[model samples]
Target: MGDIALTTLGQDIMARLDEAARFSEPGPGVTRFFLTPEHRQVADLVRRWMEEAGLAVHMDAAGTVVGRLEGPAPDAPTLIVGSHVDTVREGGKYDGMLGVVMPIVCAQEIRRSGTALPYALEIVAFGDEEGARFPTTLIGSRALSGLFDPATLDLADRAGVTLGQAFADFGLDPAGIPALKRDPEKTLGYVEVHIEQGPVLEAEDLPVGVVTAITGIERHTVAFTGKASHAGTTPMETRRDALAGAAQAIAAVERIARETDDLVGTVGSILMEPNVINVIPARCELGVELRSPERGIRETARRTVLESCEEIARARGLGFEHTLGYEEDGAACSPRIVAALKEAVEADGYRPRELFSGAGHDGLAMSALTDIGMLFVRCRDGLSHHPDEHIAEEDADAGARVLLSFLTRFGTPRP
Candidate 1:
């Protein structure tokens, strides 16, 4: 098999992507979260694909599916390729699914091309990358990285169902979580192919983005409290409007983020207590997410934002409180993986640009414990997490080819 064979593999991978896209709402967008029926259905489909590719398969108690091409030496380290299959609310068809399917396509191509690799190849499709239902992130990758703990199992969704319950409902055993942790010593490296979910590649007219670092994320839930009073009765000077104080704090967060080159802060969600039209808000709750490639910048911006909010609350005679939410440490790709991607891109005749992710991912979690790398494909109009999010089929296919080439080089170990 040669370059033409790779084009055939690309077409096959895209066909699978389209099939998965059809499983959910086709045009409007796809929505599949962890432990949901859609999630299970997709997982089953991926497993069948793995079987067709002639790989041994298994799903850990945490619901991560692994398809293994045994290495000649069973004890030798393994090269793992995977990304989550779950989608965010009204998410695009390609975001996480590309990462999941690309490895399978590559595995099939490797088998056909008779490429020999030094290490074993394991294709994985993680369960929950979106965390749309649980309000937590990277559940599947965290389990593999040994970062998951009892507390994680006890975490409840918005519906008040524990993660254990969700696992149980999905026909997985929650008590066997200890077995889910992958031994870092047995792992060679990890690679993932995913849509950029941003506009960097499109803006640069590049088809592929080799990730430099996964941005650090800091999440905070802030609450502002004040006396609830009639809007008309509260005098302009004496009134302690919680919403007013929150607005000022939100503005401060934006200012701090804009002060740095890579820092970004967003107050995307907010709620006003006792939301009566004529009443001054008694309390206001807002969620702030700050991200930066540099940890120092992230910490500094978060601290500055918190301090500014406190000051605003004190001056305005309101009570201010904030609690730290989820955090993902930034990860820089392994030099070996980066170089390989560069070679693969050039070999495939596509220009490559170094990029950083503003959002967190399963790869970020895996990066904590092992050598992990990521690739980003372009998204249409830079939109994501919305029904209108999209990616061109040709671009998606291009990403798969680059990924398949990288995986072919990594080659699976025969068990």
Candidate 2:
């Protein structure tokens, strides 16, 4: 097949993405999560696609759907390509699903042409990258990476269902997750194609770019406690308003993040008790998240924000508390994989642009298992995690073609 095949391939992959979007919950946009009916339906669809590509397919203990293309040697090391299948609330059609569908089409093309690969090829679609249901993220990838902390299974969701019970309800044994871990020695590498989720590529007039590194992320749940009283009865000088203290702390978070280079902080979720015009708020709870490519910069910003929050609480005579929810350190892309992707982009008639990723990805978890690489396709308006997320059809074609080029040339010595 020549370059013309890529356009047809992109159309095929886009249709599959649209089909997968149908399984989402009854909402404004896609709202699928792990261990739910939507997950089951999408898993079945993915299974059929992989099967059509002439690959053996299976769903792992953590609900990760895996497709395998055996090479000449059964025991030979394998090249892994995949991304998460889960989506956040009101998510778009191409966040995680795009990465999965494009590879399936490439696998289909590989099989159709009878191309020979030196190593076995495996395509995976992780079940829970969004963690929209479980309050935890990267369950499937972390489990496969052998870095899963089993205690996460004990954590509960909004409906109070634990991850372990949900696994059981879906007919999967949580005990088997440990067995799903891949051996580092026999694994060649992992490659993922995803949306840029930023405007750099579009601003530069590029369809795709190579990833240099992913930003590390840390999140904390903070709460402030104070006395509850009637707003009319509580005087401004005597009232210990928890909400007021929380508001001050939120501003501090923003200020600190801006002061530190490349550091971003946000307080997206917030709650207050007796949230009415006539009553003084007695408690306030919020989620504070911070991210940066450099761990030292992220850590320093986190320390400053935490201290300032506590100080504000003390001044307002409100009790303060916080708990660390999740953290994943930043990781650099493999040099070998980056070089191969760069060449692949050039081979496909596009200039390769390398940039640091401000967003987190499944590759962060996979880094613990084997080498990792990423190809970022331009998205419309740099929007993600919303219903408006989009990418051009030609851009999708570019991403898939580059991925195919990278796969065919990788795992061999380059001239």
Segments in model 1 whose C-alpha atoms lie over 4 Å from true places = 1-7, 25-28, 135-137, 151-162, 223-242, 273-284, 311-319, 410-415
Q: Count the backbone clashes (under 3 Å) in each candidate.
A: 11, 0
- Residues 1-415 of candidate 1: C-alpha lDDT, one tens digit per residue: 2354445655776778888876663446898888978888888899998998889998888788889998768796888888888887777678888888878877877776787667888888888888788867687788788877767777888899988889899999867766677888898778888878788899989888898778988889999999888888778898889998999988898888788788889999999988898998899999999988789888888888988999999999999899998887788788878878887888789887888888878878888678988888888888887767777767777887888777766533324
Return the TM-score for candidate 1, rounded to 2 decimals. 0.86
- Mark the 10 consecutive residues where model 1 has the least summed lDDT: 1-10
TM-score of 2: 0.84
Model 2, runs deviating above 4 Å:
1-7, 151-161, 220-252, 269-287, 304-326
Please write out the lDDT profile of model 2 over residues 1-415, one tens digit for every residue. Answer: 2343454877777778889999999987799989999999999999998998899999999899999999768898998999988899889999999999999989888888888888899999999998799878888889889988889999988999999899999999989989989999999988888999999999999999999788999999999998899889778999999999999989999899888877889998999997988888999998999988789988898889889989999999999999999887998899999999999999999999998789989899999999999999999999999998998888888898899998888877657
lDDT of each: 0.83, 0.90
Q: Give the per-residue Cα lDDT of candidate 1 at 92.
A: 69
